[model samples]
Target: MDDMTVRGRWIRVVATSLCGVLLLVGTLFGADDDFPFGPFRMYATGPDPNGDAKDSRVEGTDITGRTVPITEGNSGIRRAEIEGQEAAYVATPSRLSEVAAAYAEHSPGAAPLQSVRLVVRWVGIRHARPTGTYRDEVIARWTRP
Candidate 1:
């Protein structure tokens, strides 16, 4: 090969090698920023039944027969109400740190507590009289580690 041809090929190889090196370096150390990972997921499973429960009897033939009672108690009626007002949001690491800082500023003693998972549960509202006002209660579970 001519001298110029050999020099040109050598330069091309060096340029490619330098580009690869720069790419690797950028991937490793370019951005030291935190990104949002997850807000997680939650699901509710169980009964949300309907019908009267009073005179309804759960006979073995009830599932196959047509002579069903319209009673109040045995109707197997149920419902679920979920409140997501206080759900957590996923944020970047820096944002999380800011949140921690805010928590620390407001409640110094509670800052040490580690929040892991949040559990949502159903609250049942029952009425005393037929026209009585309903009551609300929250059923919750928490995970600590």
Candidate 2:
């Protein structure tokens, strides 16, 4: 084969290899995916049992056995006691407050408000599930009290 033809084929091969490497790297570490890459920010993950309370509290242990506090801003803390055959989950007021703060910081366009309602809808199960399997899902809504 001619020297020019040989050189052209080598360039094509190199270009193809570079493209493949780039595509692989993009697929592995691209930031355009819909999933969030940061920490899990879920507060609660179950059913809402409280009818409504202006101030409420939920107490429980985190995945690390540390006390988890769930508190309300406007005297809206309601009690939700989840009972199982062998155990019960109680959410505390301070834990609820932490959830609210995290939500407020993470939510887009959340403004300083007079009051906030934090609702814990789920409690994490410890031994019954895997680590980080239990998620306490919470919802925070700002209102004029």
Candidate 3:
């Protein structure tokens, strides 16, 4: 192959330098929104060794009073989606009705959900080890009237 041109070498140097600067700035100040250039906090940090670990899930009470798990297969809504918007759901519990609606649309033949709730199970941990104990808390709920 022929030797690289002067302008091509300059372009490569400038691009590499710019990328390094962006990465430095992102590491120091960027959040998840600046991925690829910014650090992903989830991977950058470790969980508290002696703290409770949160396990979030959505559950529904059918019209027949039976508890049902609301999974992506059943509701077409992923667990991550729920966790990602957890604050919004907690702020407005009524929004859980949308999950119930999604379940209804996906499972037409199944019993209808009478209520939907976001539940979090906090498992106790000590020295990075699970203690085989957990407490469930309801963070949000929506009931059909």
TM-score of each: 0.20, 0.21, 0.97
Candidate number of the best lDDT: 3
Measured on C-alpha atoms, candidate 2 has an lDDT of 0.40
Each candidate: what lDDT? 0.32, 0.40, 0.98
Highest TM-score scorer: 3
Off by over 4 Å in 1: 1-4, 32-145
Over the stretch 1-145, how does candidate 2's per-residue lDDT look in tens digits? Answer: 5566878999999999987776666656644442243222232243234322122334333334444343333223334421121021223323334444553454435442333334343444344442333343434333332
Q: What ordering of candidates by lDDT runs from best to worst?
A: 3, 2, 1
Q: At residue 34, give the lDDT of candidate 1.
A: 17
**Model 1 agreement with the true structure over 12-70: per-residue lDDT tens digits:** 99999987776576555544331112211222233334311121111111222322221
Residue 59 accuracy (lDDT) in model 2: 38
Question: Of models 2 and 3, which has the larger lDDT?
Answer: 3
Tens-place lDDT per residue, model 3, 56-139, is 999999999999999999999999999999999999999999999999999999999999999999999999999999999999
Ranking by TM-score: 3, 2, 1
